[model samples]
Target: MSSLISIVLPVFAVIGLGWLAQRRGWLGDGGAGALNAFVFRIALPPLLFLAMARTPFEAFGQWRFLAAYLSGTAGVWVLVWWLAPRLGFNGFQARWLTCLGATFSNAIYLGIPLFETAFGALSAQPVILIALMMNLLLVGGSLIVLQAVSGEGTRAAIKETLSNPMLFAIGAGLLVSWFDIALGDGADRLLSLLAQAASPVALFALGVTLGVAGSGVRFGRPQWVLLVAKLFVHPALVALACWGFQADAINAQAAILIAAVPAGSLVHVVAARRGTLETESAALILLTTAVSVVTLTLLLEWLL
Candidate 1:
């Protein structure tokens, strides 16, 4: 329990500091945007690059881990989308937003930091793998779903996915790792410095974003669904899948923890870009993030 607190509290505290900074007007109106730009362009790409560069192809043999994670995550996505209409969440955008809120984990901004804190930076193999998996499957698939239903062209989605710097970094890192290309000590150290900044800055930017957009939205049916689905149903399914797949202990625990993270920023991004349920999406992201502290802490105590 104490260990879990040690991991969970400090991360949330930094996020809270950012929220406070935003609320107190310490951050300018564009502060969150600027910080996010830096994190995405400067910090995260190097972090992912380094992580993939170090990850051996042998680690990719954990098909069981991917099997479990995919089953759980995709299961949540399908279930939420199917149930949304029945629950009176009408329209493609609304249902998609609800499904996204339920299934998308904040793997980048929050998951990396928490996993690094709990399991150490060397364990970032699974962390990065899981993050990459989530982004590709969930976010990528969301666009396809939107295209099929809402008449949005999948061409844009394909372009965006192909052009993403993080994915490019991951691919480059994999080639380097696989072929054993050695970047010298200086380049490695430079990347390491940038990588170190990804977590805190990303978390701070997330908090600032929440401070900017998470308010003025009253709790509604969507929020209620997000509350239960994100915090409970999704994680529970992932844990069950882990057991079912007989995943190795370490990967099983990591997979479960990854599933337990909050609604990701991409949910809001999708909603905002498409002019959908922005307020509710923001509320879902904020609500799930706040509640995951308790939920994940309990989960870690049990898993440990």
Candidate 2:
């Protein structure tokens, strides 16, 4: 109990601080964007890079874990995609957004920080692997879905995915690890310094984003569907997959926790960019994040 509180409380407190700051106007106009830019462009890339670069090459060969996790995610996506039309989200954009909200986990902003707190940084290999897979599969796949639904050319989606610094960092890190290249002490220290800033900054930025984007939003039955699918169904499927695959206990728990994270803000970003379901997508992000605090804490207690 104490272990769970110790891990969960401080993370939520920082997020709460950011929410309060935004509510109080402590950060002026565009503050959230600036913070997000810093985290995405500067802090998170190095963190992911270092995590991947330092990981053993064999860690990349965990095919069973990957299969289990991706299977759960893909299942939820397909289920949401098919159900959206029946649920009155008949438009392609609406259907795509619903599918995205169901499967996309906030792996970078929330998962990494929470996992680092609960399991220790040295134990983040599973989280990193899952994050990488989510980025490639969920994020990349969203672009293709959007293009198909909205008649938007695949060029923009392809460009966005290819230009993602986090994806590039992951690839570079894996390459370095695969080739056994050493980035001497000087480079290591620089990366370590940048990596140290990812968690707190990301949490704060998330709070600010919630405040800004969730303004005047109202939830309905569809929103409830999205929340339940993301927070419960997805994780349950991942846990079942882990058991079926006979994964190690730690990796199994890690996969379930990652799957339980809230829907990513990227869903909202994509919806807004495509001019479809932007407000609802933002509301879903806020609701899922606010609710995930309790869900995640409970899951951590059970898993630990």
Candidate 3:
């Protein structure tokens, strides 16, 4: 129980600090993108690589863990997709945003910090694997759903995913890990510095993004559907998956934490870019994030 508090409070503190910074105009508006870009491009890559390098691949080599996690995510995605239409979100709009909200998570920003706090240094492996998995889902799953929802050019979305800096970084990190190449002493030190910077910068950026999202106009069927999918259905499905897989304590805890995260704040950006429910997407990201502090804390205590 104390571990749950230990994990969640610091994260909400950072987020609250960022929100306070934005509220005070200490950080400029819309700077979240810049902060997100920095983490995604620079800070996160090294973090991922270093985390993976140290983790024994043999430990994570279990297909059951991978399948369990992926299936949990997929089950939520489908539930959201089905429910959105039932809630009166028809056509591509419902499909795309439902898919986005159901699958995407604020894993890198909130997930890493929270897990590290709860589990110790070894948390990095699960966090890294989860981050990598989410990134792949974001690029591939997000694009495909968006394309289907918006009826946009599939070729263009594919290109954008391929060109995404985060995806490229994850790939590089995995490659470095697989090949057994170390960053060495000097380079390792530098990369470690950058990796350490990821959480703070990303959280601050999240604040700026939230500020922007807060100002946006929202609410309607779309918002309702998205909120339920992200806040309720996703976590429920993840819990079931964890039980079904008979995951160990650590894996089960990790899965629950990952499941409890809100929709990625950047889902709004994706929606805006693709011409979907921009306001609602942004709003849900902000709303779910706020609610998640309580939701995650409770779930963690229960799962742990």
Q: Which ten residues in a row have the lowest lDDT in candidate 2?
A: 144-153
Task: Identify the leading candidate in terms of lDDT.
Answer: 2
- TM-score per candidate, in order? 0.95, 0.95, 0.88
- Pitting candidate 1 against candidate 2, the one with the higher lDDT is 2
Report the CA-based lDDT of candidate 3 relative to the real structure: 0.73
Q: Which RMSD does model 2 reach against the true structure?
A: 1.5
Q: Which stretches of candidate 2 lie over 4 Å from their true place?
A: none
lDDT of 1 by residue, 1-304 (tens): 7878988999999899888989998977789889989998899999999888888767768878778988998888888989898877788778877788898899899988888888888777776788887787778777767876777678888787767788888888988888988999999999999999999999998888888877787777768776788878888898899889999888888888888989898888888877888888888888888988899899878877
Poorly placed runs, candidate 1 (over 4 Å):
none
Clashes of 2: 0
